[model samples]
Target chain A: MQVSVKYFASLRELMGEASSVIDIEENISVSELWQSILESKKVVFDNVMMAVNMEYVKSEHQLKSGDEVAFFPPVTGG
Target chain B: MLIEIRKEAFNAYAEMQYYLDELDIDGQYGATASFVGTMRDFNEDKNITSLTLEYYPGMTEKHLETIVNGAIEKWNLLDVLILHRVGKIKIAEDIVLVATWSAHRKDAFESCRVIMEQLKSGAPFWKKEETTTGVKWVEKNTPGF
Candidate 1:
């Protein structure tokens, strides 16, 4: 399976890219995918917010093919 | 319920008037509550010149719709008009407008606050300010409470 991942705000700056499409094994959780990305990028973040397919999701949520996953810093809008 | 993400500046008063005129919900609303947030020229002791706002396009719309829907249900609102700006914004420019209408003042006022607070803390929008020293991404928003 494959998913499109996106980084926003400060996370985008840290990740050094806006978005990417990556192949992933089946039954992969959101946290696992994030860990893999962090490991590969050699970056560390204490926390982040995640969304799957445009909706907020728990880290334990499983990924699916064609899912648009987003990770971003805390929001600051009014 | 109306939710919009704008890439350019907007006048809140004119927008509210136009929205009311278009919807024509005249007799139903006895009270109209609104909150407009503007960019400040200074932040954290830095003189800010402008700001660059960013958001997740599809997800931002969806999240705003959800916020509006929740407010409508909780307050039994007659209507809601929300407009948020993205892209570059100058100092003292209007960044967001949230207006709520209801038969009574309490619901209108409370729901408007709720919506704004929720948006401040939860919405996908992010702001990077052009400060005197350098540009910086806002780490967090003020507490909603």
Candidate 2:
């Protein structure tokens, strides 16, 4: 399955891409998918928030194909 | 009720005036209050430098909308507008624009305050400041935002 991941703030600076499409193993949970991202993009993994379908989610949640995953840094704006 | 989140900068006086007139300002409205948040040159013993802002494109907008709706429900507000800038921003630049109109001055101030407070602890946008020393994440007054 193919999923698009978006990087924001420091994560974007680290990943060097605003968004990317990757093919992952089928039936992967959110936790496993994040682990893969860490393996490939450790810098972003260090400081980021995970979101699926525009909603913040925990690692145990299951991800569906073509989900728009986003990684955001800490809160900044007032 | 109106909500806008974008990367481009906005003129404070122009945006505020235009929105007020467009929303059909209530002549009885005793007060209209605004809370403008700007990018400070320094933070927590850090020297002045540049500021970069980021946000969840989809989630940010959605959350902002919900917040606006909440304010509408709770206050007798005539108008409310939230303008946020994305991408790179400079020091002392206007970062966020929030305005509220109501039948009374107190309501406007209270509503605007509530929106900004909730936005700080609830919005999905994040900021990072880059200085000669190094870059660091911006922290909020309230934890777990």
Candidate 3:
């Protein structure tokens, strides 16, 4: 399966790209997908938030084909 | 309800007038409560020069709509409007506007406050503060209700 990943705000600055599409194995959780992309255990996953298809989701949420996964920092807008 | 995310600045009075003119209130609404959030010159003991707001294109609107709907369900509101700015904003410029109209002052006031509070922590928008020294992403300290 394949999914589109998006980075926003500070995460976008750190990632250097707004969005990208990547192939992934079927039924992988959001955490696994993120780990696979960054290949880093140093990242504090608890500090970040994830959204699937524009709705908030847990890191353990399962992903499906063509899902749009977004990772961003906590909101600070009013 | 009106929800917009724009790069250009807007006149709050004009927008309110337009909304009132278009809606058939028929003297049903007794009060209108509004809140405007502006860019400040200082934050966290830093001399802030400007702020750049970024949002998730599709998700931001959805979250805002959900918030407005929740407020309507919780209160006896006749109308609601939310306008947020994106891109670079200078100090003292309007960054967000939230307004609510209801037949009673209590409902209008409570709904307005709830909407603003929800928008602050629930919406998928981020603020980058530019100080005299450099730019930094603001850390979220306030918890969402």
Q: What interface RMSD does every candidate have?
A: 0.6, 1.9, 1.0
B28-123: candidate 3 lDDT, tens digit per residue: 999999998888998889999999999999999999999999998999999998999999998888888998999999999999998999899789
Off by over 4 Å in 2: A25-27, A40-47, B6-8, B139-145
lDDT, candidate 2, B1-145, per-residue tens:
6678767777766788888777665676778889888777777878858877777767988888888899889888887889988888877778888998888888898889989988887688888788879988775545422
lDDT of 1 at A62: 94
| Cα error, candidate 2, residue B18 (Å) | 2.5
**How far is each candidate from the true structure, as Cα RMSD in Å?**
1.0, 3.0, 1.9
Please give the C-alpha DockQ score of model 3. Answer: 0.81
Question: Local error of candidate 1 at B23, Å?
Answer: 2.1
**Which of the two, 1 or 2, has more DockQ?**
1
Off by over 4 Å in 3: A40-46, B141-145
Q: For residue A34, give model 2's deviation from the true position in Å.
A: 1.3
- State the DockQ, from 0 to 1, for candidate 2: 0.53
Q: Candidate 1, residues A1-78: lDDT per residue as tens digits?
A: 889999999999999999999999999999999999999999998769999999999999999999999999998876
lDDT of 2 at B116: 90
What DockQ do the predictions score, one after another?
0.91, 0.53, 0.81
lDDT winner: 1
Q: Report fnat, model 1.
A: 0.92
Cα-based TM-score, every candidate: 0.97, 0.81, 0.93
The superposed Cα distance between candidate 1 and the true structure at residue B35, in angstroms, equals: 0.5
lDDT of 3 by residue, A1-78 (tens): 889999998888777789999899988999889888776424443478889999988889999999999988889997
Per-residue lDDT over B1-145 for candidate 1, one digit per residue giving the tens place of the 0 to 100 score: 7899999899888998999998867788899999999889987889999999999999999998898888877887889999999999998789999999999999999999999998988889999999888999988887767
What clash pairs does model 3 have?
Answer: none
